[model samples]
Target: MLGKILRIIGIILMGLASALMILGGIGTVCIAWFPENWESLAMMAPYKLIFQTAVIFTILAGILGFWATIKLARRKPNGWNMAVIALLLSLATAGTKMYFSNMARGSVAPTNMRFYFSLFVLLYFLALRIPAIWDKIRFEGDQPDEGVGGLAGGAAAIVAGGLTLTVHLWAGPSHTVNGINYVAYLQTELLAAGVGLIIVGLIPLALDLWKTAVSRHTSETLKIPVIDNRA
Candidate 1:
């Protein structure tokens, strides 16, 4: 019963994360190409509030998802490490974002902040892939087909991560482009790609949640013991 509830909660949290990703993605894309329009958007406190809220929610969902995965994998001696790494990476990304935001101010080049943000975003995607790799390696014998879903999900994450990395590379250290600082432009691009990848990544997560719930239901009905009962 507890497992079922946790799975349900995970599903809900994943959905919320997906929604936040979408909002963050849209905001990033809009601001990337039309930074001037940001002032207008910012004027709408609700809109800005929503974007900020999405960031916070994504961080929370990431933490919850990581925790749930670790709990589910407790029986598996080897998987806990991957879950822990993912959790740490997610937290790091969120923490770095907060740090950058705190340091950023008007018309100032956020060189260090942008670099760290990009690096952390890359790590976030990489960390997310750890579980998929572990699942593939650990469950291939018992569940020959089980790893396929995670592999696909991992591939998607890689693509998203690659996009973010590209944005980061294009956004080099403070430089000049058309009288506008390149760092500023890079910041916008990186922000857009980061949010976009996060949004895209959420789709697979939602699917994973749905699949998890279905699997849980099926397993419950079968009444098969998953582990040794010996004390």
Candidate 2:
């Protein structure tokens, strides 16, 4: 019962996080296209600060969702693995972004550092998705406990990471101006990362639905014994 309750709560938190991600994505995309709009809003410094506060809140909510899932998964083997990987990926991505942001602000050109950090974030995102894919395939009762789904998911992640790395390698370095443009770039990346996270966050809920359906079916099929067998 506790597990069920926690799982439900985790799902709710994950959904909330996903919604925030979508909002953040939309906001970032809008800002990217209309940089001038932000300039005008910049005049209202307090409003701009409020917007920043919202962004931070959104990030914190996402982190909380991930942490909640991790906590709920403590006893469940597969779920635990998924939660741990997701949490680690989230942290690594955040760390890499911070590192790159600092590098972009410093006097020296940290092109290599930036590239590698981006690659690291990409890899972490890919790794995080593995558990989602595994959850999908392992939902069925007939499936063996051989961990095949996880291995397949890991392979898929490897391919994804490789592709992202290729794109990073081909992409040119972003220009920075007083760290303003760097901030914009970081926001853009965060938006993209949020989208990825939103997708991952949805997976567990979908898996839970699938599991509930299976359980209901199984329960309905089971026959209850009475003193006498009656129609």
* TM-scores of the models, in the order given: 0.28, 0.28
Q: Candidate 1 at 159: error in angstroms?
A: 7.4
Off by over 4 Å in 1: 1-144, 149-152, 155-171, 174-180, 186-189, 222-231
How many backbone overlaps does candidate 1 show?
A: 0
**Which digits, one per residue and each the tens of the lDDT, describe model 1 over residues 44-157?**
333344335535544454555434343332223433344334445444544543444344423223223333443443344344346644343331234333324343433344
lDDT of 2 by residue, 1-231 (tens): 332333343333333332333233233332234434554323334333333444454455345544444433332345434434443433443344334434433321222333343344335334434664435433224534343332223233233333333332322233333434433444555446545644554564466667779989999889686686584
Q: Highest lDDT: give the candidate number.
A: 1
What local distance difference test score does each model get? 0.42, 0.39
